[model samples]
Target: MNDSPGWASPGPAPSDGRPPENSGGSGPAGGAPESTPSGAKWSKEQPPAGQWSAPGTSGQRSHAQTPRPQGWNGAPQGGGWGAPGPGGWGGPPPAAKPGVIPLRPLGLGDILDGSVSTARAHWRTVLGVTVVVAVLVQIADIVLQRFVLPAPMEITADPESNPTEALRQSLESMQDSMISLVPSLLISTVGTLFTTALLTIVVSRSVLGRSVSLGDAWREAKPRLPHLLGLTLLLSVGAMAILTVAALPGLLLGSVGGALLSAFGVLAASVLVIWLWVRFSLASPALMLERQSIGQSLRRSAKLVQGSWWRVFGIQLVTALLTFLVSMIIVMLFSTIALFTDGSGMGELLTGNSPEFGWAFLVISSIGAVIAACITYPISAGVSVLLYIDQRIRREALDLDLARAAGLPGYGTEQPADHTPGS
Candidate 1:
C-alpha cells in the first residue's frame, strides 16, 4: 500500500457523493488506460461513489486504495461499501464475513494473504494431501537412487587409449546417468500432477469459505485424474518440443559458428519457455476447477492470461523463488547432518570416484526433499489458485458470484441497476 505498484489501503469514502478523484480527474488514480492490466478498474454505471472513478481520466491516483465507507463516528464500517450513507450511497449493506478473501477485487497483498490464510484455515486437509504426495515421491526417488540406478562402469588406465574412444566413453557415462534419472523424474512429475489437481480443488473451496474434507477433495479430484495427467503430458511435450527447436541451431551448425548460434538459440528458447510457462501456468487450476478438458484448459489459461503477462509472471516468479529457497534450506540442513554423521565422501561419489551413494546420504537427502515438498506444495498451489480467482474477479466480475456463494447479501445482481451501458 505504501506506494507499491498495485496495493492501496482502503480509505474512507468521500462525503460529497462523488467518485474519488485523482488530482488530474476522475477514474482510478493511476494514469493507466481503462484496459490497464490490474492496477485500477472502472466501476459500472452504479459504481459506488468513492469506490470507482469515471472511465478515461487517466486516474493518476489509481494506486490509492479506495477506503471502505465509515460510520457516523468515522470508524470503518463492515463490508466493502460499508453502511449506506445520506444519498443511499456509503456501505454496500451488511454481508457475511469473507473467509479467505474479501468479496471485492483484490490487491497483491490480498492475494498473497489469501493463500496463506487458506492453508492456515484448512491446514489439515492441505497439509495432509501434500504430505501423502511428497512421501510417495520420496519413496520412489529413494528406490530409484538406491536400487534401480546402475553402478558406473569402472575405467582402467589405458596406456594407448585413443582420444575418440575416451570421448565416446564419457558420453556413454553421461547417457547412463541420464537413464538412471528417468524413473525419479517420472515419479516427481506424476506426484506434481496429482498434488496440483487435488490442492486446486481445495483452494477453490476455500475461496468460497466452504468446508472440504480430504475425502471430498479426493472424490472431486478423482474424476479429473486422467484429464489432469493428459494435461501434464501435453504441457511437457510442448515444452520439450520448444526446447528441441531452440537446440536445433546448435545441432545443425556443428562448427564454432553453429555453437555460438546454438547458444544464442538456447538463451532465446529459455526466455520463450519462461514466458509460455507463465501464460499457461493456470491450466492445471482451470482444468481441475472448471472441469475442462486439457485443450480447453490451455485455451482458458491463455485467454485469462492475456494482457496480464508481467503481473502473473512476477507473482509466479516470486512464489517459485520462495519455494526453491525453502527447499534448498531443508536440503542443506539434511546435508549438514549427514556430513557430520556419515557424509564422508559425497564429493567423490558425485565426481564418479564412487559407483553409488551411501545409504545415509541418500536417506537424509530424500527426507529433506519430502519435507520441503510437503511445506512448499501447498503455498505454490494456493498462490496459483488464488491468482486464477483474482483474474476472474477483475475481468469477469466473479466477486458477485463468489459473494453470493458465500451467502453474502445485497450482491445478488451481477451489476447494480445503475450499472448500465448508457448510465
Candidate 2:
C-alpha cells in the first residue's frame, strides 16, 4: 500500500516456512519434459547484463526508453526523496508542521525560531501575561529599593590609617548589598514562577497551532503552580545549601587561607550546581505537560537528558546569554534616559558617589526593566518548553503524538489486523 502523508503503511506479513508445491519442476509433476517452440534457438553470443535493448527499440536508445536511475528504494529517481519533482514525491513529504515548528527532531535554530514564532503568533496572550507579571515585579522591586531597603552604608574609615575599621565597614557594605538583594530575588523568583507556568501552557498550545487566551493559560497553569513552586524552591534551597556547606569549613577556620579555601570550594560547588541545573532543566515543562509529580518530573528530565547533557547545556546557556544581553541593552537605554532626566542623579554618579535616585529616576528605570522583562519572559519560557518538546521528539517519537493531538489528516489512524486497505 502507498504511504499517506504523515503516516507509513504497514509492511507485508511474515511468510510461512513451507516451500511452493511445484518447486524444482520443469513440467507439471517435477519432471523435465517441456518441448521447445519451433525454429526458436538459443543464441551463442549474448549482450552483457543491463546492456541489451528490448525488441522493437531503435539501435540508439531513446531518452524515454532509457532506464531511469534507481533510487535507494528502487523508485525511478527524479529529484530524490522529499525534493520537489513532477509528483511532489521526489523525496519523503515534508514533515507535518501543524504549528510553529515542524513535527520532527528539531535543530537549535528550529527551537529558537519556534519560540519566537510562538510569541509572535500568540502575542496577545504571551505579551499580556508577561507584561502584567513583569510590571508587578518591577513595581515591587522599585518600592523595595526606594523605601523598604536600607540606604547604602557610608564608609568613613581611612584604609591606610585604620585598616581594621575600613575592613569592618567593607564587610558591612557587602552585608547590606546581600540583604537588599534578597527581597529583589524573591520578587523576581515569584514573578518568574507564575510566568513560566502560564507561558509553558501557551507555548505548548502554540506548538499544536492552537491559540490560547490568558484566562485559559491561567486556568491550565493554576493547577500545576504548587508543584512548580515546590520544584523552584527545592532547587534554590539545594543550591544555597551546597554553597553554604562548601564555605562552612573556611568560615570556621576564620583565616586568610581559610577564606581562599572557601572561595575555591564555592567555585567547585558552583560547577556542580550548574551541572545539576542543566540535568533537571526540563522538569518544569515535564511537570506542567505530563502532570508528573515534582520527583517524577525530575527523574523524567534526567532520563531525557541522560545522553544529551552538552546539547541541553549549550542551548540553555546560549538562551540565557542572549536574554541577558537584550535585557541589559534595554535597561541601559532607559537608565541613560533616566540619568539625563534626573541631572542630580547623573551628577552624583559622575562624582564617584552613590546616586541617590529620586522618584523620577526610579520610575523611569523601573519602566525600562518592565519592558525588558516583558520581552524576555516569553522568549525564555518558550525556549524551555520547546526544548522539552524537541528532546521528547528526538527520544520518544513525540512528533506522531503531536500530529495526532493537532488533528492532522492521516495521523493516528489504526487499521484492523485482518484487513489491509489498498493504496
Candidate 3:
C-alpha cells in the first residue's frame, strides 16, 4: 500500500486463517508464496520478526468511488491487482480489479462498514447470542446486588448540615457501594471477558466466512483462558499501579498543585496504557486463529501495528461514539422522567416509584441495557477483528486472502492445485 512496508513471503506453516508462505502478510504482488500457513509455522524460518511491509500499491481514494469487482460500485472495494503488464514477473495476481492499488490500506469507513455489515449479515445470530449473554450477565449482577451484598445495615450515617459530615456521608456511600460490588464485579468481569472473547471469535469467523456455533466459539476460547486472564490482570494491575503512583506524587502537594500534577501524571499514564491496549487488541485473534502463545501473540500484534496506530484508534472511537448515540436515543424515549432530575440532581423519581412511568424506568433500564449490549457488543467485537485484518492488510498484504475468501474473480485458485506452496 502507499509507501508502507513491502510484503514478506510467508514462512513454512500455512495458517488456516492466512496463507503461511506470506510471513509478510502480503504475498508477492505477482505470485502467492509457496509457504502455506496450514501447519505449525517455523518462526525461525520466517523473516527476522523485525518490521514488516507490503508492495505494489496504487490509486488514492479517488474522488468518485471506484467500482467494486462485484456490483455496488460505491461500496468500498478491496484493493485489486492483475497480470503484470510487462512490468514484473507474475505471482499472486494483485486484486483482480483494474486500476486499483494493492495497498489501498483500510480507512475508517472501511473498518466500521465491515463491522456493521458483519453485524447485519448475522444480525439474528448476534442479537440472539448477545441477548443470552446479557441476560446471564445481568442476572449475575442482580444476584450479587440483592443477596450477596453486606447488609446495608452494616453501618449507619447521620444526615447533617456540616460540609465535612456530608463529605463523610458521600465517601461512606461510595465505599459501601464498592464493597458490596466486589464479588459481583469480579464475577461480572470474568463473565464479560468470556463474552468478549466469544463475541470476538464469532466476529472473526464471520468476517472470515467460516461457520461458527456458540459451542464452537466457546471451544475456540477455552484454551486461551489463561492468556486472556493474564491480559486482564495486566491491565487491572497496570491501572492501579498508575493511580497509586500518581496519588503518591501528589500527596505532598496542596490540593491545587496536587490536582494539577496528578491529572498530568494520570493523563500521561493513560496514554501509555491506551497504546498498549491498542497493541494487544489483536492478541485474542492471533491466539485463537494462529494458536500463538501469549508472548508470541503480543509481539505479532505489535509488529503488525507499528505504523497504523491512529487509524485503529479512530475506528474504535467512531464505533463507540455511534453506539453511545444509539443508547442515548433509547434513554431519551424511555427514561425521560429519570432524566427529569431536580436541580439538586437528587430529586428525580422513576415511574416505578411514581404511578406515571415507574414501569417505564424498569423497562427502559433493562431493555435499554440489552439493546445497547446487542448493538455495542457485536460492533465492538467486529471493529477489533477488523482491526486485525486492517493491520494485516497494511503489513502483510492480507487483502489478497480476503479477496480469495470473498470469492471475487481473478484470485483464481481451484482447491488443492491452486494450494501449491504459495499458490
TM-score leader: 2
Q: Report the lDDT of model 2 for residue 406.
A: 69
List the pairs of residues colliding in candidate 2: 80-90, 81-90, 81-91, 82-91, 82-92
TM-score to native of every candidate shown: 0.72, 0.76, 0.65
Give the clash count for model 3: 38
Per lDDT, the best of the predicted structures is: 2
The Cα error of candidate 3 at residue 398, in Å, is: 1.5
Decoy 3 TM-score against native:
0.65
Output the lDDT of residue 323, model 1. 89
Residue 361 lDDT, candidate 3, scale 0-100:
46
lDDT of each: 0.67, 0.74, 0.57
Selected candidate, larger TM-score, 1 vs 3: 1
Model 2, 296-359: lDDT tens digits are 7888788778889999999999999999999999999999999999989889999988788788
Sort by TM-score, top down from the best: 2, 1, 3
